[model samples]
Target: MEENRGIWVFIEVTDGKVEGVSLELLGAGRKLADKLEVPLAGVLLGHDVRKISAKVIEYGADIVYMADHAVLELYRTEAFMKAVVAMAEKYKPEIFLYGATPNGKDLASAVATDLSTGLTADTTMLDVDPEKRLLEASRPAFGGNIMATILCKKHRPQMATVRPKVMKALEPDASRKGEVIEEEIHLEESEMRTKVLQIVKETTKTANLAEAHVIVAGGKGMGDKNGFMLIHELAKTIGATVGGTRDVVEAGWLPHDQQIGQTGETVTPKIYFAIGISGAIQHVVGMKNSELIIAINKDPDAPIFDVATYGLVGDAFEIVPQLIEKFKELIKEKGGEISYV
Candidate 1:
């Protein structure tokens, strides 16, 4: 236990803003910190990155370790790994948390390997065991039917990557403040392994699953495009967002960002509407962390019912329209707009 130390959260950022999963990790990290009675630290890397550092404290970081460099601005796995490895070597934190984003996972895997520490990826839950000085990393296995807890025993810095929206970000207390641990990278720009010659941002309909309080997702059982559209309409009337299972996304009915499953974006909306979804194990892994789940499928025995707070046996097309209308009425009475349409 003496070899293990404090917690470190990677502040994932893109488009000049910190990613949603980073905040969720902070919230989860804060719990681990309090339980262990140690500091919760955040690590950041990029150019002009100070802008996002303050929010980490507001969310719940006791200290922020920053290494702002031009090479780190864009996610070049090798360079990012170098900076992180250096930090770990300099200041050895017991546990390191990263988001499940492409960049985060790639860098974390490389860092964990180089540092000789174990890493758990796509974890849905995290808890620190004080008696054992262990970090319990929980993630779904065999689809969503089972969950496995991983431990990195006899490791100096245990590392884990968690899904976005799986854990709640603590509400910021503006009055709260924390220390910032500034760091510098001594390597010259020419020493970098990868060079970023040009950058092109993809233009696509990227969904806002992070900002959504309510999300309505349709799966293969939606029957076709029309069935999925009905689910989208319901999401609109409630001012909610629209999502889909991997099948729906593959069908080209929804964008990649709207896909919620083991290989897709993980979401934990306040209210989740699963329409015509068969509740495959992969799909369940992503949204099982949701606060409240409401499932509607014709099959009464669908696996979705296992975790749903509200389960209804009915046709999605028929039920979705009804729910949309009901939501419209409710929102209108209270004066609000449904944006999903």
Candidate 2:
């Protein structure tokens, strides 16, 4: 373990820009590195990724390990895993963090398997013990009822896959300078199992709840489909996105993509409205990290209020309508057009 030193974050890139989760992990890695008194580094993979190494440094990494190759242009489990594992084996990092995206999970799993090390998945919280040099990775466990902190005691490099939007990225400073080390790995087209034939992006309005500043979410307490319309009405008035609890999705009030809970998308919006939600543990685990949680429910003892900044104990039916009207009036005063009808 003497060879392993710095903390490394996998900088996942898509199209051209670096993924938000990668930057977030860099911010997180910065803190861990400071505590452990080690350098914070970023592992960047893909063709034409040299320029991205600068952005990674600006985001808090002290060093950037870049691998640029034709075969690495697209994300394939085989080519990416080979390059990443090679880098890990050559220049050992004491701690490695990857975003819990589709590609991230696949790559992390394969690398962990090859290295014979522990890899925690979907981690929500992260901390480190400088004394033991243990990377404490915490996540919702037992169906979101309890938080289990995982530690890789016997592993040389502690690895974790953190969910996107769960961590915040540092403000990039272009003035900050760092080192960029170029790495190379041999990859053959025939050896790879999957090929990137075409990249077709979704044309529909994707549910970007993770990035929404304000979200109005409902639950089964919303009664029926028509009752759920009130949620949409308020969301439209405030120019916010509409989300739902697991029960609402099961009831066909919203699609599964719009659900916010342990089994759904985790969100950390600036302001979150929990309308007609009972605040089950599964639901709270997803949105408890929101900057400002405003819960509206008739039950005073509801669990959601435990983490909410403001608790409105009243019927969402009565309060939501009045709230919509107030927002409309406020928008009008600000010279903005808003219609509740």
Candidate 3:
């Protein structure tokens, strides 16, 4: 453990750009590195990814270990795992963080198994003990009822796969400078077991709740499918996106993609309207980072109010309709071109 030094974030490149979650991890790793008084580094692995090392440094990495090769052009678990494992063994970072995306999770698991290190998956919170040099990775456990912080006491490099939209990224500084260390990949395309045949992109049009400026998320308190329409109407009127709690999705009121909670997509919109939500810890972990949280529930003591910026203790059915009318009037007053902000 004493041999390990610095914090490393796996910088996943997609479409020739850094993934948002990877950048977020860099922001998170910065704090841990600062606490431990160690340099923050990033592990970049991909073909033609040398140009992105500077961007990684700008985000917060003090050093970037890059492995540029054609075998890594597509995300093959075997290829990425070999590169990451080699870097981990050679450099020996104190902590390693990866995004909890499909590819990120796949690569992290393989690397952890090869290195025989413990990995905390779907981590929502991260902290480090300066004295012990242990990475405190917390996530919802026991069916999302309580948060359990996992520690890798015996491991050389503490590793975690963090969920997206839960952490904030640092402001990029164009003038920031960092060291780029290029690692040699020992694998070839012929040695790889998996090959990329073709790429199929999803053509379905769904509400981009994660990037929405404003979101109207409802829960079982909305009563039923017809009652849930109030949430849709409000969102539509305000030019916002519609989201739902797990119960709402399970009840067939909303699709799984629109679900917001520990098991759903984490979102950090500009404004989040949590209507008729009781604010379970599971649900809060997903959207608690929103800029402005407005929770409307008949129960004044609902758990949601604890984290809400504004709490409306009233019937959502009555309150939402009135709000819709007022918003319509406001839109009409503004020539039907009002922005929700």
Candidate 4:
């Protein structure tokens, strides 16, 4: 355990570009490393991904462990797992962080099993006990009612998978410099059990709430499907994206893709309008990071008020319609054209 000394973030590269979540993790890991007084390192693996090492350092990594190989062109579990495991055994980082994307989750789980270390999945918050040198990985637990912080007291490399959009990435610094250590992969394609067939991308059109600049998210307090129409009306009028709570999705008022909560997608918009939301921790965890949170609910003491920048204690039906009209008038004043994004 004493041999493990630095913080490591797995930099996921796709189509010759680093993933946003990887950059976010690098920003987060940098803080932990600074507090622990250890170097922040990034583990980069993929074919032709050497160019991304510089970006990783600009994001906050002091060192990048890169492995560039043809077999790693696509994300194959066997190939990635072997490469990461070998790096872990050699470098021995005190803490390891991965994005909660599909590929990241798969790789982290495999690596944790092989390394026999404890891992916390879907972590929304991360902290460290500098004295004890423990990673405090917290996430919604027991149906998202409360947050539970998991710790790996006995493990050498405390690993965690953090949800995307929950953490903010630091601004890039091109002038920042870091050391890139290239590692040679000893495994070949013949030794791998799984082979990449063909990749298929989703072509469906859906509400991209994660990337939306302004989001109007409603909860069950909106009454029903008809009441939910107000959410869409306000969103369309303002050119903002529409999102719903889990209850709204379960009631078939909105599609699952538009649900915002712990069990759904996490979002960080420039402005978030939480209408008729009671603000359960589950729901708050997804949108608490919004730059401006304006919550409207009938309950004067709704938990949403706790984290909201502005709280409206009234019926959303009356408040939202008035707001919609106000926005429409404002848009009409500006040549009937408004862009929120």
Candidate 5:
């Protein structure tokens, strides 16, 4: 229970490496830490995961509380929840933030239930009330029409789960140091219910849309698969990733990973191309946060132009090919090392 009062981020590790969402949570946690004038801590739970805490330190953690046990090797909903609940019982942190992953949400919900504490889910933003000692968690509600901020006013360890890719991770600073506290995990392997049979990772034969800085995304306006083909050409020429709207993904023009909307992946690429898409509130809410949006649609009355930084009233089939040709020529002339990130 010593030195436990602070903002804490739940660190997620897969195959002994920290997840990007974990680092992103740390970055968000640092802001709350500064606001509260308390240390920003990272809570790492796993079996023999000592090597992971150093990376947490680089991502702006002022302290890391680690719980290593053989029973914690793989994620079990009950075991992890118990371990985390035990940690919470001891330290009593003012604020705790979790990534909105399947495992994260599962563990968080269970822990909140056990502790009889308040918990908010899929928060897009977080802030602290210095006067009330409250954690304000805001998330999109009812198809992104309204944003609701929830409060856990009475809970000692106020908790919220935030969506992935919604927050930015801080640049790693090797010089910025922190503290690591090793804890003894009291769970036995015999008490576990589920066992991990096997782990199969999904393979997509395309660029990681979430990681791409320059994303050329098409929506239903792309018309057909052929329309998406033109999008692919431009994206390939400029070394950008391809993404689509929910309509296109449902139509099988692209995979689910390439989907960029409310039910799909949230993106903030430097340049986003909305080809042939009539911007719906559902779609726009996701990519409206992009740095620069360029919309290409035949309909001048398309709702996409409202949020687009640049609007092109043209057919994507005709325009995308020209854009591809131009980009290839420009890159050929310049040659080598053009990064959109």
Candidate 6:
């Protein structure tokens, strides 16, 4: 723990830009680093990623440990893991965080095996003990019924993978100054077991519920597939994206991509409408950071109301149609088009 003194967030870059989750992790890392009075660093690995590395500093990284190599451009598990392990061994950070992204999870699992370190996945909360220098990684346990805080007291670098949108990022400051440590990676193509043939990105509009400004989400209380139409109707009138709970997805009322919960996408929408959701911790962790939360359900004691900024104890079936009509009239008067397709 003495040698491992800094906080490090793995920077995720795609299409020549830093991912939002990585920036958010930097913000979270900044707070932890400040609490521990340690340097906050970002690990940036990619070909010609120095430009992106500088941006990580602007996002609150006090130091950026960068490894730029041809094999690092595309995120193959083998190449990224090798580079990251090399950096971890050399510098030795106290806390290492990665976005719970596909690439991040893959690399973390592989590297954890090699490094013989404990990795807490899908961590929703993080804290550090300045006295003991322990990273308290808290995550949902028992099927999201409770919370668990994991401590890597014996480990050097306590690692965790955090879901996207679960953390907030600081405002970028172009004037922010930081140090850039360029590390050489001696990885070759022959060492890699996988290659990026073609990156097929999902371009569907609803693929990213996390980026939506307004979200209208339903839950099992929605009852049936037909009953869930009210969610879409209301979302259409308000120009908001549609989302559902894990139960709604399991019932085949919506696609898995639209689910908002621990096992699904995490979002921090400006306005979130929780229609018929019972406010489970599993679902709340994904969207508790919403700027405005409005919950409507027949049960007044439903847990969803606990986190809701505004709560209406009424049947969503009865209330949603009225909401849709009202918004439709309002949008018509304002000449604004609905966002729902």
Q: What residue pairs clash in candidate 3, if any at all?
A: none
lDDT (Cα atoms) of all candidates against the true structure:
0.85, 0.91, 0.91, 0.92, 0.86, 0.89
Better of 2 and 3 by TM-score: 3
The candidate that achieves the highest lDDT relative to the unseen native structure: 4
- Give each prediction's root-mean-square deviation over alpha carbons: 3.1, 2.2, 1.7, 1.6, 2.9, 2.0
Q: Mark the regions of model 4 whose C-alpha exceeds 4 Å error after superposition.
A: 203-207
Per-residue lDDT tens digits of candidate 6, residues 1-341?
57778999999999898989999999999999999999999999999988887799989999999999998889998889989999999888888999999999999899888888889998989888888888899988898898899888787789999978778899999999999999988988887878888988785645658679899999988889998998988877787899999899999999888988777877888899999999888899888999999999999999999999999999887888888888878888877775534
TM-score of each: 0.85, 0.94, 0.95, 0.95, 0.89, 0.93
Q: Write the per-residue lDDT of candidate 3 for residues 1-341, one digit (tens) a residue.
A: 78999999999888798999999999999999999999999999999999999999999999999999989998989999999999999999989999999999999999999999999998988998898888899987888888899999998789999998788899999999899999988987888888889988763323377678889999999999999999999998999999999999999999988998788878888899999999988899889999999999999999999999999999998999999999999999989875655
List candidate 6 segments past 4 Å from native: 205-208, 336-341
Pitting candidate 3 against candidate 5, the one with the higher lDDT is 3
lDDT of 2 by residue, 23-127 (tens): 999999999999999999999999998888899999999999999998999999999999999999999999999999999999999999999999999998999
What does the lDDT read for residue 14 in candidate 4? Answer: 82
Q: Show the colliding residue pairs in model 1.
A: 144-281
Judged by TM-score relative to the true structure, which candidate is superior, 3 or 6? 3
| Per-residue alpha-carbon lDDT of candidate 5 for residues 65-171, written as tens digits (9 for 90 to 100) | 99998888989897888888888888888788899999999988998898888899999888888867778899889988889999976666888999887788999
Clashing residue pairs found in predicted model 6: 279-304
Candidate 4 lDDT for residue 331: 93
Per-residue accuracy of model 4 over 1-341 as CA lDDT, tens digit each: 99999999999988888988999999899899999999999999999998889999999999999999999999989999999999999989999999999999999999999999999999989999999999999987898777899999998799999988777799999999899999998878889888878887764324378778899999999999999999999999999999989999999999889888888878888999999999988898889999999999999999999999999999998899999999999999989987754
What TM-score does candidate 1 get on C-alpha atoms? Answer: 0.85
- 30: Cα error in model 4, Å: 0.8
